[model samples]
Every structure is written in structure tokens, then in C-alpha cells.
Target: MYQDEIIQRVNNAAEIENSNEMLIIRKIEESEKPMELMLNENDRISDIKIRKLVDCIVGRKIIAEKVLLIRDHFVSLHDYLDLLNSGCLFDDEYDALFATFGNFEISCIL
Candidate 1:
């Protein structure tokens, strides 16, 4: 159900069966200079999510359309323990992350 050569396989299948699916794709030959932004501890989790969204979509011909686009940065025990002491509740953390993802999906659809 999953293949990396999706486009080519789909195109070939369309040719074999003469499918009427219109896959309108234009090759964008544009290149962009790499940009950088520095983030500090003061940045909110939502800001971090927006930065990740920029990495996913801006100036790219192909994109991975998945909800779980960004990975967790603070995976170690020390990270959570520090946040634990800093008073970031688990429910609030979950709410912020999911809310960001929901907004990101809506933005992409619109």
C-alpha cells in the first residue's frame, strides 16, 4: 500500500489502463538560497510548529502531506524533567501541539 516510486508507478498505470485522471504537474526549475532563523528557549511551541511548516512547504515542488510532520525535539528524560519543574502541564502541552497541527491542516487546505 506504500511505495516510494508513487508518481512514476501511477503514471505508468495510467498509461496501461488509459486512465482519465488528470495529474497536472509543472516542473519548477527555480532554486532558492537557504535561509536561517535562530530560535531560543523563549520561543513558544506554536512558533516552533510554524517554523517546521515553513520547512515543509515553501518553494518546493514536492511535499509530504502528513499530519505528523514535525518530530519531537525533547525526547530525553532531562528535557521533560526540566519542563516538569518549569510547570508546563501535560494537558496544556498536548492541547498546544494539536491545536497547531489543526491550524496547519486548515491553512494547507485553504
Candidate 2:
């Protein structure tokens, strides 16, 4: 299934879990300014995934748990691709990009 489909499933499930999910969305929206500043500071890339994930989580496009899971497993190439595939990033060609920067380690951020 596509990422959008997966996101819809997650939203539906979250709604089932809490009937007032919209309220949570509204609360999150109210804090958007500071959140954007924090994201800009924390995000190390010009990549859209970081921004999209921020949007998705704030809008509850996907669940917090799923986002956290993706963030946790970002060290793996496969997991990284999965995140990119999920509309979090704009990699038209994953293989080429991976080939070019595969050896770089996230820990070696210097």
C-alpha cells in the first residue's frame, strides 16, 4: 500500500482510539510557530522529509508512534528508503542517491 493509504489507516485508527482527535489537532496547530522554529534548528537537511514529517505529525497524518519508529530506525538504509517512499522526502531516484552517499555515517555529522 502507498504511504497515503497507510497514513489514512493510522488516522482512522487514532480516531477510533480517541473520538476527540480533532481537538488534539487543534491544540497542536496552536503551537505551530515555535514548532517551526525548532524544526528549522533541529533539521540538518534541506530535505522535505524532515518538514513533511513535521507536518504529518502535527496534522496527525500519521501517528506519533509510527513517526518515532521511523526516526529511531533511520540508521538503516532500507528504513531510510521507507521513510523517503512515504512522501517524507523528494528522492526521485533512490538508487543513485544511495550510491553517492551510502558510505556517509549519520554519527559523523561533523
Candidate number of the best TM-score:
1
Per-residue CA lDDT of model 2 for 1-110, tens digit only, reads 36576678778888678655442322334423321111122334435654565355345433444445444435434445445555643333333333323223332321
Predicted candidate 1 versus true structure: per-residue lDDT over 1-29, tens digit per residue: 24447778777888789766776655443
Give Cα distance to truth, residue 102, candidate 1, Å: 2.0
Minimum summed lDDT over a 10-residue window in model 1 is located at 62-71
Question: Which regions of candidate 1 fall more than 4 Å away from where they truly are?
Answer: 1-4, 22-101, 104-110
Candidate lDDT (C-alpha), each:
0.41, 0.43
Pairs clashing within candidate 2: 49-88
**Count of backbone clashes for each model?**
0, 1
| Model 1 TM-score, all chains together | 0.22
